[model samples]
Target: MPIHSKLPDVGTSIFAVMSGLARETGAINLSQGFPNFDCPKPLKDLVYKHMIAGDNQYAPMPGVPALRQSLAQKYRRLHGCDIDPDTEITITAGATQALFTAITALVDRGQEVIIFEPAYDSYVPSIRLCGATPIPYKMQPPEYKVDWERVESMITPKTKMIIINTPHNPSGQVLLEEDLLALQGIALRHDLIFMFDEVYEHLIFDGIPHFSALRYPELYRKSVVVYSFGKTYHNTGWKMGYTIAPEELTREIRKVHQFNVFSVNTPIQHALADYVNNEEWYSALPGFYQEKRDLFVDILRQTRFEPVDCKGTYFQLASYRTISEEDDLSFAKRITREYGVACIPVSAFYVDKSDFKVVRFCFAKTPDVLEAAGERLIKI
Candidate 1:
């Protein structure tokens, strides 16, 4: 008998594989991009308080009204964009769910979805599951910047959407205003939907500004902006996120979202709403994360590995050429087993993994964990 699988090429994710290896080898696990610390006490207390106040139940199909409204206020305050929460926002289980829902809602069979590579792993699978084609345009390493000519060439009549992630994962590069403008040009010329995954929006470092697709009103009309609370709040296990789109686009996305997860945990939504509304808490995030990022980079400077300049995200990419000439995956495993440190190969995020020789380490860990990993890495 043959196995039935819609996603035949997909198997265990790199995060899971590296995590299992870390556990087996008793290595400092820096492969997956998750914080090794607890969320803010205020947010946690709010969650418990909401539970005590009997806010536990199914939220509305869209989301709790307070959360939706708060999200709207956040956009206005941060991005200088006005969004009608009642019509333009629909919360999902997480940004992962929101991405899938948007893809399913917007794409048709045989359509092409332009994706920047080495993209988040989930994007490809979601596009494939929607019966659409993933047209990947690679971003060169070191700089990890997009080539506008290549991107423009990839657009076609069948291209329905282009997915962009700023404060990019694994690469730790942030999309610039020029990059956004380039994408806006393509969208305007070709009439393609623009989707931005900005879960790491607030994690930018070194006084770098995050450019949002919402900054352009024309682009926003045809864009779906997805964000995750898990990334911002250090509560990845919570898995709560929402999308901001025009009313018509949101209506279609909600059709898929309404039946998929229906709604998120009611109390979690309410608590998150209160958290976002607090200006002081979210405002300090850049400074908070910058410290950890700088600490990890400083430690890497003492090692043979040359860490890339990371403008945003908790991840920092290190080139292992000075340490070994081995391919990235093999080098990652070698370090994990012999050095007692775990990191993800940059190739894991690429469509073709043969050429890349970098690995990603999560700097979201505590100073002690970073020091331990750094000690082992430098010794090697």
Candidate 2:
């Protein structure tokens, strides 16, 4: 009756923990990274039309041809890179599954994967499940800049992959062109595969253009770039996402992906194929989220918490050093219970749970919800 857990150290995700606590305490839950508003009605209508048109069954093992082709065209228009839908693109249940499948396929047992912290929670566990080791490089606060020189110094013969996230979660920092160039050089020099998590690609702000790995030939040659339709359309629950890679790499990824989920939802895939063709829908995302960022920042100015510079993504980090010496997790819980506002402790994103006296709040809610959360946050 004794069961040895593959993930013995892992427990309930902090998102679930905080969200459940928020519900119990009647706090305004901003701990999880999801929109509190509905996606466009037109998108919903498209899904209805597709389902009614009998797209409810299993999609192709790779994906529906229409959705893959649309994504291929999207890559061509956005990154100026031509992708073969039949050979290079595959849709998954979410970006998370694509990440897992890619890692599972590429990372061999006893190999090593270098990851930067504070990373998204899923990265480490996925790497561990592959029977590989994760070599973590800590990026400091106030900037979270990667020291490429230091990164190269940590490389070893056993190192097989490097993972990166842009418009990063909890921190919201984006990678610059120089970072991409450095990563390209390193991956080529060591013959290491690179995985780019760009789920928040469209949420960049302040006129800063996103730098995709697809932009560089060297990086794209040895990279798997993951994207999320759920994140893009503000319907995270739909769990639709895809990955782009070279034909060789994608062939390997599909080996795992076929057994993983077989394919994503057929109706959602059909609807997304039609919806993505409209440039107007996605083009406005940066400006849309930027307004929310600016509004949230402006409101936080009324409080003691110092807001960090958020270049992209809908999450905002605030240092509560002036008000509390308590660790981030404790402060997060205290505020949730007493102030009726819930946020994720940034420490939870790090493997060590390193407390930097910072907490992350999701600002992707409605203006009124943000206003209400701001009122509670300001009271602290």
The best candidate in terms of lDDT? 2
Residue 187 of model 1 has an lDDT of 70
lDDT tens digits by residue: candidate 2, 103-164: 99999999999999989999999999988999999876778888999999988989999999
Q: Kindly report which residue stretches of model 1 are placed more than 4 angstroms away from their true locations once superposed.
A: none
Go through the candidates in order and give the clash count of each: 0, 0
Q: List the residue pairs that clash in candidate 2.
A: none
What shift in Å separates residue 280 of candidate 1 from its native position after superposition? 1.6
lDDT of each: 0.89, 0.92
Least well predicted 10-residue stretch by lDDT in candidate 2:
138-147
> What lDDT tens digits, residue by residue, belong to model 1 across residues 278-376?
888777888998999899999999999888989998999998887788988888988999999999988888777645678999999889999999999
TM per candidate = 0.98, 0.99
